[model samples]
Target: MTIDSPSLAPAPPAPPGDTAVHPTPARTPSAAPERLSTRAKLVLFVLCAAQFMIALDFSILNVALPVLGKDLGMGQADLQWAVTAFALPSGGFLLLFGRIADLYGRRKLFLTGLGVFAVASVLAALAWDPASFLAGRALQGLGAAIIVPTGMSLLTTTFPEGPQRERALGISGTLLSLGFTIGMVLGGAMTDTVGWRSTMGLLAVAGALVLLAAPKLLSESRHPQRPRIDVPGAITVTGALLSLIYGLSTAAQQGFGSLDVIVTLVAGVLLLAAFIAVESRSAQPLVSLKMLRRRSVAWGNLGGIATFSMMSTVVFLLTLYLQEVLKLSALQTGLIFGVQGALSAVAGVLAPKVIGRFGARNTLVGALLLQAVFTASLLGLGVASGAWLALVGVSVASVGHLGAIISYGVIATSGLPDDEQGLATGLVTSSQQVGITIGIPLLSALASAHVAVLRDGGDGFAASTLGGIKLGLGVDAAVVAVVAVLVAFGLSRRADGGVAVGGRTGGV
Candidate 1:
């Protein structure tokens, strides 16, 4: 399920005398040949381990949330913050950290992030109150922000583009998808057997283990030349992302009509406008406008964001439907997803071969369509006996979900040169992190709003909840189907025009 880097229209050469501005340079895979040594395998292992840990944190707390809230004396209003606090920094800081990692060093950032995450996990595990727990979660998010981009850049740079890179990414994607599912299962088991705090403690141990292994296996990677930070672009985009994620997260729990949500969302929009303006004028932009315009980067990212957002939302809603509406225990819900995880891993392993035959763009589109079809089938989910449908629909859809995940990464990072690897990986990772953070909230808001309306219309709690969930699932299906068409047409346009991929011009 990786992307075939399709031919792209090359950027016009920068003005001959414009040395200060850094244009999007051509990719240089020759700079680092593909490595198949045992050491290379170790590097991949360590990097994937770091990635798995980050993905696990995203969902590990979810199954344990109820136990955690009661133990920490948190109200329903406060419980969401435990998740939002982590998400805000994790999603918000990714692009900024990606650029910084390029300016500084990916290896350095990787180790530093690991240390920060491990320490934060320990603090969270030992927390005595809500405030202390939240502080730890925020730090964990920051650490994840640092780790994701840097780790991805390291993987892309270390494995030269081609079959080797594709296979490596396939493994990475498998672990990432598996990590989320495993987290839910592990969270439930640990919460029931020991305590919710055990989940945090497990992460702490994982962080420490990966941290110790990383330094020996990872080499420092950064831009060949050190450019000054794009301070204005940095400030505006960071502010914008932080504001936007906060607004959405708040809306998830409180509804979007609140004054607090309105103001924050407006500020986010303004700051985002400022960021665009700043980058347009900067000599060294935080993100190259030219790169953003590339079909592979733009459309690839759109597909990436859409797939992750919709798939994660599907999983989240199913978790609710299974546990709340069906009255299934947490462990029972986890077992269903555990099966989904196994199928996802199989799909991940097969993705590279599928990409080789069908091409990344086609694979991406087909995968999304498949995901849409299966997701839509979940509309058959009923109040009494539809748990089987949830299990089948999600598991089968995940086969496509895993393909989309791997293909989008390849498409996004395939064409960029070595120096911009960090930024490219950042964009890829940002799409993913942002997708994960926002999806649950956005759709949850929709479902909740529907439930409120149904309740006001005199529907019982059970009926109203079911109606809201069905509405959400329907929208999710339509959104994925739309994105599939968009990505298909978008990439087809580029192929017809003859675009550059790996310094060669041809069709995808």
Candidate 2:
């Protein structure tokens, strides 16, 4: 095996059952190295930078949407695509690309994804029309599909599994959260002062820098016995995800009555079912159906969906309340979100310690419960409710979000062998993107349904909107409560005197 390597993957756990899940990939000696070299640190920095870039792109557009629409002469009715385009590919293609990264070189794929992302950013920035801009966003989503899974697989492979890997993942997680916060704060300021285009342009510049450094700093790694790509599996799964998410997103705007939405949603379900059938029969499947049977991988992903989905729904509703009801400026809205972001950053750092004490399942359950409680607290919001209440509630919930991120990630990825790390990361990443993509639209529909009744009762537009929003929060809280129970009961007792999920005891 190659030595003195610059792998981005975290070293796996101690191999269990004769599996090579935790290989150091020619890096660390059998014993821990006394220290990492400067080159190793640089390589890590580049990887984190790539992660930060992906996360940044996800949030930067949040505050800029209104102005971007206005400047391009786009109608409000047609503007959702700017966000949907990115979501469709990012959430859609993750599994396919994760396998591709394993077949191709991680370093090469990482660099290529960055290049595509950068070029797409330029297209978005220079776009003079909605079509071109949506196209650009779609391409960005494709790059995200490539970047996220590979970046995660690299980080896992690069670091040693114990404290070293924990610390590295913590830092990487912090950067990812920081990117979201930074984007919001920066989006508001840049959109107000420079132009919304600056946000896209900024991504291009950041992506370019990461692309340049990655090839020089990061080493390539792949499976020893190469596996064939599963094309049918890829097409079916991506199509399913994109179609489902698109259908739901359309519901937020056009309601559930649209024929297009119904057709797509039904197609998505059918396609997902088909993908499962294809996977079961394929000699070389894109995703081994057996992986989903791993309780930890399965339940942890469900928990991840809960984490991102609820948080995103809360943010979306709060943004609407802040801007539309209270008439806050984009800058104010960004700053408000920035506070939660800062708290989220702090939580990210402490998440590892929290998990150690609580255990993974308990941590996830508690976090979800906390998020549910805080989200439900927003149900009391009204004209009398100050922005400070919103801030405190959102901030507190973000702390739970931190725990959810750490626990769910560890639960899903731990104990997996090296060859399957890409697949694991892809699944985890897809849950997150899907959660973000569908959360807003689905919740909005719930809110709208409630609002409709309030309007019938003679409430003003603002009051009806608020009433509808609170109902949505109540439902969101209920979801967390139910999932928390599911997470608690999901594990079976293991032989090693530990709770077993993914059929592993004591994490490989």
Candidate 3:
């Protein structure tokens, strides 16, 4: 099931007219090397900006969901779809886009994806109804699927390994955290004052600026050997992920035992199995299965899934508590959440230094443990608790969670080679998206079940809801605790350098 490096394969000759655009044979990796210049720095900035836009879109819409629902006459189900539609495609299509980038040129794919994303944002802003808006969101997700991996590949290929790549990755990771925070603040303000549509328009402008700067700043990478597209493998995998995410989204509305949920889950599992089989036999697989054999990649992705699942659930539940329980205005709630977001940005900046000092595995384990403790404390806050206490708990928990997230990114990407960095990035990002997709339903179900128990014991709606929320947070804390233990044990078993097979160690 392993996909070997395509660099080991023979390359096709370039067409005569393509010579000018393509790198000359003398400048190839096999010949004289060219170092990235100052111009490349500008290109890296543009690429990072595009990455920020894509990441921001994921969280930005959360604060605007109510406004969008009201304006478009969207019901609960439709509102959920508006969010899920974007995430499903973004996660499902990442591997496909990563493979496409490898086959074509990274720079070409990055710019193309950014252009498509910008256009999609414009369509999203112009939508007059739920269906049209959801359609636009889905298209934007497809564009993100292309933009993310290609951007990562461009950074990896452009910057030489060592201080340069480390600095680039650090900046890239920081921007991602910054985007998530800014999305909340901007989404809330725009939805309140200008309208949700204006928020999408802002994204469009950001994307356009990135596109304009890309050409002048970026240079094309040396094309890899001609690689065949793994169409069947891609289809199967994408289908599997879509089915799984759809099933989870459906479970949020329909109980898990429903026939539709069962069918979709079963079908998804079957399709994913088929995808694995196809990859094993395909000449050029979309995903390198052998990469999973690396303990760091596997365990790091696992930790990422758990970490994001907790994070997504916490954010959702906290927002609900702030608005419903505490009766905060959207703007006030956004400002409150902004505090955590700001702290998260700080955490992202400090995470690498913490990891370098303590080691990635140890840092991850510590962060997760701190997250679990803070999450459990937050769960202890009853409806009657002081507002300040709730705010303090959330802010502290967020800081811990942010550190855990950055550590997970460092752990997952640290071990991969330049060529395989895209694969690692795609897999880890997909895992995080899957976590977010599943978090809502899974936590909601747990909370609902707790509410049922409390109601049976004569609790009222308010009491039952608070109890349910607490129970859900408790469940998330337990999950994070398990992940922490697993990470600690896994790291302890690794070699002295903490390098897993097929992965490097040193940066974070």
TM-score of each candidate structure, all chains considered together: 0.92, 0.91, 0.87
Tens-place lDDT per residue, model 2, 1-508, is 1114433343344323311112112223222332456786776788889989998898888778889999999898887888889988888889988998887777778888999999999999999899999999999999989999998888766654444455556667678777877888888888989999999999999999898878777777776678788889999998999899889878989888899999999999999999999999999999988778676788889998998888888888888888777777777878888899888888887876665444556677788888888887887778655588789888888888777776777777765666777888889888888887778788889898889999999999888888887887888888877887887677433423234332111232
Task: Itemize residue pairs with steric clashes in candidate 1.
Answer: 1-351, 1-352, 4-360, 7-499, 7-500, 8-499, 8-500, 9-499
Cα deviation at 20, candidate 2, in Å, is 22
Evaluation by lDDT, superior candidate among 1 and 2: 1
Cα deviation of 420, candidate 3, in Å: 1.9
Global fold similarity of model 1 (TM-score) = 0.92
State the weakest 10-residue window (summed lDDT) of model 3: 18-27
The segments of candidate 1 whose C-alpha lies over 4 angstroms from its true place after superposition are: 1-25, 28-35, 495-508
Q: Global CA lDDT of candidate 1, please? A: 0.85
- Tens digits of per-residue lDDT, candidate 1, 56-133, equal 998899878878999999987889999899989998999999999898888899899999999999999999999999
Residue pairs in clash, model 3:
415-504
True-vs-predicted CA distance for residue 362, candidate 2, Å:
2.4
Work out how many backbone clashes candidate 3 has.
1
**Candidate closest to the true structure, highest lDDT:** 1
Lowest lDDT sum, 10 consecutive residues, model 1, at 14-23
Candidate 2 has an lDDT of 0.78
